[model samples]
Target: MTYTVNCSILLTELPLLERPAAAKAAGFDAVEFWWPFAEAVPADRDVDAFVNAVRDAGVQLSGLNFFAGDMPAGDRGLVSWVGRESEFKANIAVVAAIGERLGTRAFNALYGNRLEGSSPEAQAELAVENLSAAAQGIAEIGGTVLLEPVSGTPAYPLKTAADALAVIARAKDAGAENIKLLADFYHLAVNGDDVRAVIEDHAKDFGHIQIADNPGRGAPGTGALPLGEWITRSRELGYDGYIGLEYKAPQAEAFTWAIRPVAG
Candidate 1:
């Protein structure tokens, strides 16, 4: 029930190396970021340098992102370049190397949007197929990929936690164990009919959890939802992994809350 900070909140100002240092300064044990490496760093700026920064900062990397878009509904490389399979596989391989460098083993693989005229079932199958390939590549590098389900607002159609879990289970049945759920509380509260029950019911399938209050998408204490209470309750139910700080920081004051882990 310990917490980790997600580095996406700081991508605007800090260099990649400084992000981990900032998280440590904020009292976090670890930090996470969206895709850290797009190309082999310049001959000047290399992956080892980035990895060393985290070590020097004394923080663990919570997770890394498997890029699915450049911007809102921007080109999702997964389905668009379906024919050029090698490129898609290469994106996943780069993510694995980044994860290894950061001391993290999970990456959030976005399920692509529904294509025009495509059946819902067909879209789900395509998602499964794509993630299966990505998961296999990550597993080879000792990493896991968590499929993040968006309600199609910022990203389309596979918009529910249950929907994502179904595809994840389907992929597992097809012999891929590296695929699991990346549960974002903000997304769930936005789309899910019953949020708390959903978390309780599917805790086992969840590989990681991200939290932000609904509506504002700000820190846990800044929104209308009782996210701090939710975190407390979740720990009571045996969730002992990192709950990522995935929301934007509030302007006036920093949001801080204690996470009390429930003893077994």
Candidate 2:
């Protein structure tokens, strides 16, 4: 299996050009970012230059995290953020173009916050409609959108594996095939669900997996989460996708723990 590093850990300090080298030096096969290119601030970063840097460093660009809005409002998954459908679609198109240039296979698809005066069922419908469009946009370029479930966030709509499954099932029923699930270990831990069972049950629909120790949201060994066991079990469940290390490694030594084989 391959290892990926989430660029969110170094976004504040590193330039896009140097990220690939940094990830390679840290023993990661690929690197990803959480919304590095926002339509609101596209000029702040250069997407094409970042792609060139990845090629020059001989590292793969894994994916991008879609952070459209806050949680609580059930608008974080794929519904809509601030009720701006056109802006959301435009941003997704830009991200997909970046993915295509960088040779990335997946992108994080977030559902925005909950809408005011909207019922839970209504929120789900909105999320599916918007996500289906986003997914279709991504799929045209040979990429997929991975829906993530966050726990305790403002968008508590998809806080569990079961929640993600239900959403995917609905999308499938509606003939949406471009969307998939991104299972984050830290979020799963926070949601208090069995990670192994969740992954096994939805193995086919899972496109990417991310990890961070819960409680502290640090490197895997820094928290109480049983990461090694989960890794071992996931291996058994025929999951061979990249395992993304998406956490704040405050100390240099913290990075060392990332590549060490997990204790089964």
Instruction: Return model 2's CA RMSD, one decimal.
Output: 4.0
In the range 141-251, model 1's lDDT, one tens digit per residue, is: 788878766642653555677877877888998778888788787877787646688667876567888888767787776677767776666677766678887877632
lDDT of residue 115 for candidate 1? 59
Lowest lDDT 10-residue stretch of candidate 2? 69-78
- Candidates in order, TM-scores: namely 0.83, 0.86
In order, candidate lDDTs are 0.68, 0.72
Model 1 whole-model lDDT (C-alpha atoms)? 0.68
Best by TM-score: 2
Residue 156 in candidate 2, Cα distance off native in Å: 2.8
Per-residue lDDT tens digits of candidate 2, residues 1-264? 577877767533677568777767666668887675434226525766766788887778888765464332333544544456666666776777777877887888776556677677776776777678777888878887788788766545677888877887788778788777888888888888888788678765578888888778888778898887777677777777888888876535547774444322
Candidates in order: C-alpha RMSD to true structure: 4.4, 4.0
Worst 10 residues of 1 by lDDT: 255-264
